[model samples]
Target: MTLSALDQLKNLTTVVADSSDLEAIRQFRPLDATTNPSLITAAAAQPENKALIEAAFEQARAENYENGELIERAIDILTVKFGVEILKLIEGRVSTEVDASLSYDTAATVAKAKELLHLYQSYGIAKERVLIKIASTWEGIQAARLLEIEGIHCNLTLLFGLHQAQACADAKVTLISPFVGRILDWYKKAENVSSYPIDKDPGVQSVKQIYNYYKQQGIHTQVMGASFRSIDQVLGLAGCDLLTIAPALLEQLEQDQREVTAALSVTAAQQASVIERPVQDEQSFKAEVEHDLMAAQLLQSGIDGFIKAREQLHALLRQSFGLDEEIKA
Candidate 1:
């Protein structure tokens, strides 16, 4: 059989599974994996993972954790637990996000990230093997900057525009995960257009622009195009430093035997010149997000959605703990 598209893409770009499903990841064998509060909650709801969820809640109870805070810690433990399971099937690192509620609080984000990393270390996983995922907000980028200084790598996520990517690269982040599908989603909805050519897709264009800019500036940070909605978006960015694809889309690539080709590269990027780099200071970051209502709305909604997902996971753990409690509002 001809090499599957997934296998061919691996030749030019590192394919990271954007899921918390161990079985799916085991089958694909992606070099690394990424998880968010939403993905983890989805995994916890699975019947096969019921025991796993209960076991984690029991451990939290034994530790004398009570009330909502108990579930909070359990959420952290569950995130690491999933990471540990993923690490078992892959040799590369895993990216676990910090609480979305802390997206604007640098200190809180830093502390929560440290707690998560400590949780992973307690499980015999090296800090080097984990990327503390954070929002691309200025505060989050600041937290990532400090984290990097301490040898803890980070993946700046939910990035939409060139300014966000510029900020992440300036922060010396390990990787930036720009949302390709999300960008395309915004344009398609905003313009009332149902379909766009792959080459003309906003999401693909955004990643390619960032990739070219990064290479032009000699920035060493890696670009991982993420949140893809279709195969064209994936194939469009074939030579990105990495692509964190969902398992369903990955399975599609596995089933299709199309020959994948590299479309972005450092050598090709050398011929590309960016118009002007965006200023990404605190004031500029806030201003940029405010000016681009699309970016502002999406970032806010993504944060709110992730926060809700974490709370839902907490409620699930509480149910398994023989208690039904509400959020401490």
Candidate 2:
């Protein structure tokens, strides 16, 4: 019997579901799952998850959290609630993001991460089962460095350039999610092109560069290509350490019975010539990000998008809790 593309690809990479929808995750049965503010907001609005949102609200109410504080607490609990549910379905880790509003504050990001872990612990989930997803800003990477010291793993997200990847590896982060489709989007608009061939794709090339660099330097930081716009983009980085794909593309791969090939390997990386850079400090990291137009713009915009999604979730929670009218009055 011929294997589906998804099954064939799994042999070379760990497949992760990039969603918070319980049914979708159940169907895909990905080895791991990841959730961001946007996914959580969408999931929280579903009728099937009404109970989870209510539970989070009740828990916050019982703790005497009120008004703005209540909404904030509920959002955190709801995020963890989704993670708990996802953990029940997957054997590997679930990435729950830190509040994107705290992306630039290292201390605040660290504190929020610990608070999130504490919430997960209350539900009997181990720290090992969760990867605190943080933006790949210099401060965010520094926050991850602090968390890793305490045995708390992190997934540095919104990554676009090799500088960010290198800084993350230097921090010894457990994983980094380089946004594949987003990079392709930026290039498409700037270069005024509809799309490039899969092999010549800017997004594909970016991940290949980062993956090869890590392998050549013997870096242990795992690269999980994320935000894929299509199955071809997903397949373009075959043999990546991991790939957190959205359900739609996962479904596409599941239905196709195409042959899959490993496009990346450590053996090839060892033979490729790679340049090493000096470790980046706060000043240099900031300078490099500002210098790279794509990375700088995308990083800020990614944080802004996540922050907007979180705010939307807060608005939904307020209306659900009958505080929307009160806030207006």
Candidate 3:
């Protein structure tokens, strides 16, 4: 009896579902789950989740929040609402991202993360079961550094380069989501090529570099490869600490009965020659990110994209609550 590729991959890595759709999460049964603004927006727009959205709005309204504050509170509640449901199905942690608008503001980011944790606790969820996801800006990393001391776990996201990953490790972040497909997308457009061989894929190489470096440096921060475009990319990083794959790809892996191999190992990383870089200060961190065009562009665009998604969610909430209708009247 041959095992499915997903089952074999699970033996080598912790598989996490990257979606807010409860049915999909239930079906795939990923060990953990993650949600971002885009994912939440899409989930909130679905008719099946209408009650979740309305319930969050009512809760926010019951608290006497009005207008912008009401919508803002609802969005936070809605994000955690999805997370709480996701946690019920998965045994591991559920990553609930902070508002991307705070990506550049460390103080705001820290405050929002704490607020989200408090909301989770309101639903009887343990702090240990939640990872506050934040963008990987210099300020965001500093914010995670502060949160980690307070025992709030964080997942630094939108990471595209070594400097961002190094800074995250320095901060002792609980995890870092280095994007796989997004990196590949950037290179394909920049280099004017359609695709690279799976072995030579820039995205796969980026994750391999980060994973090996962390293993070599004895860093305890977990690496979760995210945003995969194909199952081949997922297979390429078989022994990653974790991989947050989309539901479509997860379904594909569940159906395929191919043999999977561990492409990374601690033993191999320990033997590899990796350079050690000093922890970055704010100035150096900014300079290094600026020096790398891909990282700089993608980091900003990812933030903007998330911010847009957040706004879209907010709009959906306002319409659902009839706030838009009241204003028109």
Candidate 4:
């Protein structure tokens, strides 16, 4: 039997596990790993991961002299704890996100990112071992740009459009995670499409466009395709710079024997070079993205989902803490 399609893809792109579960990460053995607050919050709620979360919280409570301080300390401790565990699993960097609440505030985004970096450092992990994940807002991009100069590599997340990719490349950031699956999800719900065409899939097209643009313009920033819906979407982006796939999809690819070809080629990207366009500024970026209906709608929708997930996590935390309060009383 020949190697599976997923096996072959590892040759063309760096495979990242888009998960927070330590054991799942261990299972996939992705080259890198990424996690957002929503994934982390979900992981923390799991019975198996509860011990891990509690250990961080207990560490926070021990260090804090007051309840207010305890809560703040707990968040930091938990974030670092997850990063540390993830670092042990993957050979490459682990992406730890900044607070989604500060996505629009450049200064606050920078501050929170630095704080996350410091927390990871306290665990004996070097700054290079971590990728600070931030929302791809204009403000967040600026924060990442500043951090990159200071040697903090960032993973620009929630990236739905080319405008975000161009801005990040211009900033000389480390990497951009363009969401192929999430992009498909939005279109699926809106258009009632059951499946996507390989060459024409919205998610695949988005990443291919961004990848070619970066290569053509000599942008050094790496593009990682993320949020995939199916194996076809993954195989469609076989030659992407990287792809962060969920464990389930990885397993599906491993089990299925299918033809995999280089859908994206350097030759194709070089062909796009002849018509290279300059990266956009703020006003033009907003305008250009607004012109693309999919990018505009999906970007707005993704931000909404992030905000909602954050709220749900907060409510869950409050309930957990309230239970703890009763236990303490």
Output the better candidate (2/4) by lDDT. 2
Q: Write the per-residue lDDT of candidate 4 for residues 94-194, one digit (tens) a residue.
A: 98888777888999989988988888887899998899998888888999999999999999988898788988988899999998887888888889988
Query: Residues 90-163, candidate 2, lDDT per residue (tens digit)?
Result: 89999999999999999999999999999999999999999999999999999999999999999999999899
User: What TM-score would you give candidate 3 relative to the actual structure?
Assistant: 0.98
Over the stretch 1-329, how does candidate 3's per-residue lDDT look in tens digits?
A: 88999999999999999999899999999999999999999999899998898899899989998888889998999999999999999999999999999999999999999999999999999999999999999999999999999999999999998899999999999999999999999999999999999899999999999999999999999999999999999999999999999999999999999899999999988898876788678899999999999999999999999999998887777787667634310
Q: Report the CA-based lDDT of candidate 4 relative to the real structure.
A: 0.82
lDDT of 1 by residue, 1-329 (tens): 68999999999999999999989999999999999999999999888887777667777778898888778877888888999999999989999999999999999999999999998898899999999999989899999999999999999998988888888888899999999888888889999999899989988998999999999899999999999999888999999999999999999998988888999999999897754775668898789888998789888888999999988887777777677565552
**Where does model 4 exceed 4 Å of error?**
65-69, 273-275, 323-329
Q: Candidate 1: list runs displaced more than 4 Å.
A: 327-329
The Cα error of candidate 1 at residue 327, in Å, is 5.7
lDDT of 3: 0.94
Instruction: Give each model's clash number.
Output: 0, 0, 0, 1
- In angstroms, the error of model 3 at 246 is 0.3
Candidate that beats the other on lDDT, 1 or 3, i.e. the better one: 3
Q: Tell me the lDDT of candidate 1.
A: 0.90
